[model samples]
Target: MASRSLADFSHPQDFILSILQASPSTRDSRSYLSSFAPPVSVESPSQTPALDVLPDSVPDSASSSAPRTPKPANPLVASLLNPIIRRPALVKIQGPFTDAQLNSIARGMAQLQKLGLVSVIVVDRDDIPVSEPSDAASASRQRTLVLRDVERLVHFLGRHRAPARPILATVARLAGEEEDDTAAEEEKRTPGEVFVEREGLDHIRRAVEEGEIPVLLPVALDPGCRSRRTGADKVLGALASSMSSAAPSTSASGRRTNLTPLRLLVINREGGIPSYARAGLPHLSINLASELDYIRGTFLPQWSHTHPTALSNLALANACLQHMPREASALVVSHRSPAAMIANLITNKPAHSASLPHALLVESEGRVTRDTPTLIRRGLPVRVLRSLAEVDIPRLTALLEKSFRRTLSAEGFYRRLETDLDFVIVIGDYAGAAVVTREDDGTEEGICYLDKFAVLPSHQGDGTVDFLWVALRDETYGLGLADASNPSIGSLSGKGRGRDLVWRSRADNPVNKWYFERSNGFTKSADGKWKMFWCDAEQRLREKAKEAGREFGGGRLARIVEDEERGRLDRWAPVIQSIKSAWV
Candidate 1:
């Protein structure tokens, strides 16, 4: 309006503001701005009065007749057309949830969606009774109920100031059922008795690419175009398979959209699969290949009748993990803490370390809290080698050098390993390994020393350390006393003796914090150049000492016994520190 070109204003806001300021007094700011011509060429100040005089009540026909430039679409939304740009996560809500819980879940997921995670939510009506449909009419009725449920879920998630434009999506079809007029085929299997055959998956991918969170309905369309109600777990499994194996689809621009299927998350009332052997507590993590059978055969029998859903969830997760990328994992979390999902997305690990002692996992009620989520993975098998011959010494030596950033004295290491090595816990093709040795102190009971804990540089921060630690501390040559009495707790680890574990590290090492958390107590070398840490087994020893003292009627001899036991850590320090260094 001041005879200024578009170049006069560096920012668009300034240009728009200048227009509002120059508007005629006859028209309100809203009317003037809406009717203003596109900022093509700036006009002289005298010409501004003609455009600003238009009233807010201008007819729609006149406005439509005039050619006006449309505002530019958001670039961020356009960029999503390339699927490779998004991290897609599948979140299934297994529910019979209260209103408050639903609100919380919606808020949490919405917050995550806003943070660039393209989430596809599956709502499982686990509360509904599972029954077979007698006829097409019955199946139709069930489909109607499913539609209602999804509608209500969409409405509720959208209504609560949630900021999520959740659209109801139909992405599943009956498996093995074709689009032909096979009414007979549709009738053979009732609506309630169906498995998902993924259809219209592109629509979902497209929606997510455009920044919409697609809330998929579990209902699948049969060959006859009639809807059938299917199990949510089956739907999740189908989706997982399709999403994980999804080939890069070519966009209109002929560029392939490569969306990665990151994680499969199941949110339920029972946070994770319960460890009935551990007094019905939730398992921190489950290595599907190794632990699935034991859980189904041993643990399922304990809680099958009460929580049959857990089995289905576990099966779905296991299937997902098997099909997904090695880095991808599945989770079964409780609705109580929706944030756990976000935390896992960030850390790619369980909220709690899987190697925590069973005694420490429980709350005052003697059961693991319902909020503890179980991370399910297609983890590599853990192997324990008692003899050096079982291991590739050169590879082990290379790993130690790489992880420690120092040369290993192969001669000294092998000598120590030959004599004192209790067990070597190796995880997944040398991704991580721990060397445990029986230290010879003056005490009658030998100390279990963690000699060398090494994880490949490429494998660090992805739970390899925790997985290997679980093997060394709980699975093989056990340390925690609670696990000693309960042999049925872990898989394939004939050892859970719950003996004391001690380890030493350079005083300046960064891993000391992590070691400190896992240990019961620690002490520094007299030279302060080395620090030693011990686990709960030390507490067990102290308790035993107190019991012995009580048995002796608290006499001078009992006092002497207690004093010696209290100074046991001090006595072991010089012996541990005096050992020749393994690194050259």
Candidate 2:
């Protein structure tokens, strides 16, 4: 009836309005538009009307169809031609999330199906429990909290890799939607029952192996995403039986011992489940540098330390950390601050893992040094070049090649540094130079990153780095940060207020101990490639924020344990090789 081509409107509402007005007669439109929804999924980015996914009201005729007798099919190709696709079974489905939020997850699941993964079973919101009363106001508030929880769950799921790859396997239970206290207790797993989960997992393993069908059995390791719709024993039992016709049996670690438990990762912000469950499960506790910002910005800014959401979220994170398994991976998304907090967390006792979760701390290049304060008087005259185009690039490249054993590309370097960079700091007549940028990664703004800090081998052991660090700090923090009263002498005084600095270094470097001492905090990432460090002169920063009349918290940070660091060597390889070829 309407001629609204697919190209016109991005908003669905606008498209619908145009269609309604396009036709004068509305009589046969309903019959025309109400086409039957697809059997597998009812939705896509398309011109057709959207439908529910396998509506319960309409039974799946495909499942009900009798198994057809085999024809004289070729032996080798028969299986491929008629592969038995298992309807993906889901267990332990529960969520306090709103319809819109849950729909996002459904979209993610649908995306997987579109990628050739199939048969995802999801629990409806009607089945989930809520702590608040069934009033419109209470429901609205609950939806907001649930939405936050779902967002974190989605982000974490999107990241799970390696041992926990495809974390959407069969593991979960929706909590009972009950009003009684006993029903609530039924939602929890006591210490002894934690053992049952282990046993159940073993049973599922046996069932999986006996039948060669590939199945995904994901277990939500954190509180926010854990389900009580079915007990672990029941869920795993269901999984085993679904994969194999035989009943699940008592089992132990055998050939399947190497199988890593599927981790449905989640960020715990609501203090949802108690500490006991976490300590018993094979779960990891991740702490990003940005949490401190959330504590400062959203929790502390314009609010006291006693704020419920802020306080509880922080407390929950700490509690989870205490229970982290000895070798469990710790994820650290980069943030420019948290130096003081990180220092407090690091431990020297080798047996105890430095009180840090498998120590994947992030440090960037050109973090400050003890030489900073002294460099104020004796520092090299460093030149700040805003753009490389302003400098003699070939000269700088030749100088870089002599020291770092790599060739540098002027064009590639400029493109990557274009926006976030502050200025290129060159010192000592081209003996050393550093690329500085304010990567506003978290809640607070202008979190500094020393993207590249290179020095000539001739100046290696000299005080060049010391002078550079001091210059960097002086330029960033301003004179007021060093001395608040006059606020007129240093780099940041007249310009915009400065943010914190972060950098990373090769883990094998001998000077790490020196860095460890000079830095507020440091951590080796889980992948063991680089050691990241940060600075948290919190007192000075608070004063600076006060002066600037800006709130100082929330790093807008991410949990970047691996993705951010991946292929860093590849990106720098060409330049390094060029330097070696041209200079060496």
Candidate 3:
């Protein structure tokens, strides 16, 4: 390889292109980008090449007086590095996985490391016992196993080949009661679990800053200097807690700045937290603050003692997320789709959405319908109110207008407030909201009408819409009628008794595709200006019609079905379309 200085390239993109085009390393395997672009397939052999690529731009120092290089001149370059410049993701991999599965995950992580998305990795050796040894001989055997597993993991990842070499490190402290610890610190500690010690963590941080991924082991030592057994999840949790409140780093101009929050990735046999309501499918996203308890109580039991490890993984994610920044999130994905991890870091979206009603449903015989990663976040709290009277009208109006890019008809909005408003779900000071109302079709049966669904333009793709949709579907609308096992039901069940949720959108709206996936049935208005969608309500009506027909005779079944269909078109459809638009 030719010698090159950071200043050789006038732009960050040029520097990146040069690195990608550099000569290939003899020792390292192909880069993860090989399949995408042949010119960028080479991996640098040096363990600290990332730091060398942009030495003049690295900004953790405080003593130097020289001017630092400008930010990446290209949007793509900045996008790749801005979110993860100083934040290293804590990836905990648990196994019983096949070699192919492990290799795929390693390849994906290596790609992320090269692109500057992740700086460190932590592997959990599920084969290693997580219990205390009965004797010294047992402890010795455990040590040998830990060493062997660490070597295998590092070597495996090494073959996938990242810019930063993977090195094995055992750096943790077993939690214990100590007089020097403060009361607040004591509350955060879990006695007998292992966490990375400050000095050891400094060593790891230095390695990362200099371009290396320290593959941490689950082993740690107590204050007594004796080895203790701990799991990888515990180690990851302790590391997250320490780093979340880590002191500010002094910059080149001597200005101290807080570090970005750390992201987490957990690779296990089970992809994500299960959703029994969706026929044993995994949840797409979980708002940890609000939905964690609901998930643990509702979803985990459905596993039926079959996946105890998955339960622990969920708990680990919740624990880790509580210490992360509000914007920071985590992914627990199956080894099958390792590439989804990289996609998530770059795109910041789950491979599949939790709000898509039928998109996540699983078929019988245990075959997965789709490969979706479960996303977990330290979500904003949701406030569910019975009426708009409790809301700040100005803020609510502004949110709806900004989200829809249209003006709201204040008179029309307030017209239904006195008689039709069912409930309002506001997410974190109106970052998103769903206003539903009860609409009577003259048959005395009131239907749940989604009057408005809005999310701030800035918050759209960062999971705000997905989070709000999940809250609406699971809590407000109530899927409990179809599946009584669903525990999220009745939490705030609005007007209808497990009836269909109906909403309308503009005929040319781009969001119709999203609505189509979540809705069971949809119909276009005759005038062609509006489209109406319902959540499995059409099927519900048909079933009811069939039941009613059974009471009379076989001949009456067809007539009953026809009557039901006719009623939907003549009564419900017109009423749904007749509800005037609240936007001008």
Provide the TM-score for each candidate, comma-separated: 0.73, 0.28, 0.74
Ranking of models by TM-score:
3, 1, 2
In the range 1-584, model 1's lDDT, one tens digit per residue, is 11222223335453333323222221122221222211122232232111110111211111111123434342222221222344667788877676666666666565445434667777767755445478768766665666565565666657533333344555676644332355576344443334333356776667665656677767666667665557677677767777766777766655344455678888787768887545666777777755677677656464776566788888888877776777677878887756556545544566556555444445322324656778888876677777777888888878777666677789977987888877777777776677878888977667877777777756654556666666666643344333322222223344334566777876765446556545566788888877887764433444666776633211112223245457778777877787777867
Better of 1 and 2 by TM-score: 1
Q: What is the lDDT of residue 144 in candidate 3?
A: 74
Off by over 4 Å in 3: 1-86, 96-101, 163-170, 181-197, 247-262, 299-305, 364-372, 389-394, 405-407, 474-478, 482-496, 538-562, 573-578
Error of 1 at 216 (Å): 1.9
Q: Each prediction's Cα lDDT score?
A: 0.59, 0.33, 0.59
Can you write out model 2's per-residue Cα lDDT over 99-163, one digit (the tens) per residue?
A: 44443433333322221223222222322342335576765654454445434444433432101
TM-score of 2: 0.28
When sorted by lDDT, best at the front, the candidate numbers are: 3, 1, 2
Which residue pairs in candidate 3 collide? none
Q: How many backbone clashes does candidate 3 have?
A: 0
Q: In terms of lDDT, which candidate is stronger, 2 or 3?
A: 3
**Residue 361 lDDT in candidate 3:** 36
User: Please, what are the lDDT tens digits per residue for candidate 3 over residues 451-525?
Assistant: 887777556555767667766775433444433222232344333355567888767654565666566657888
Evaluated at residue 35, the lDDT of candidate 1 is 21
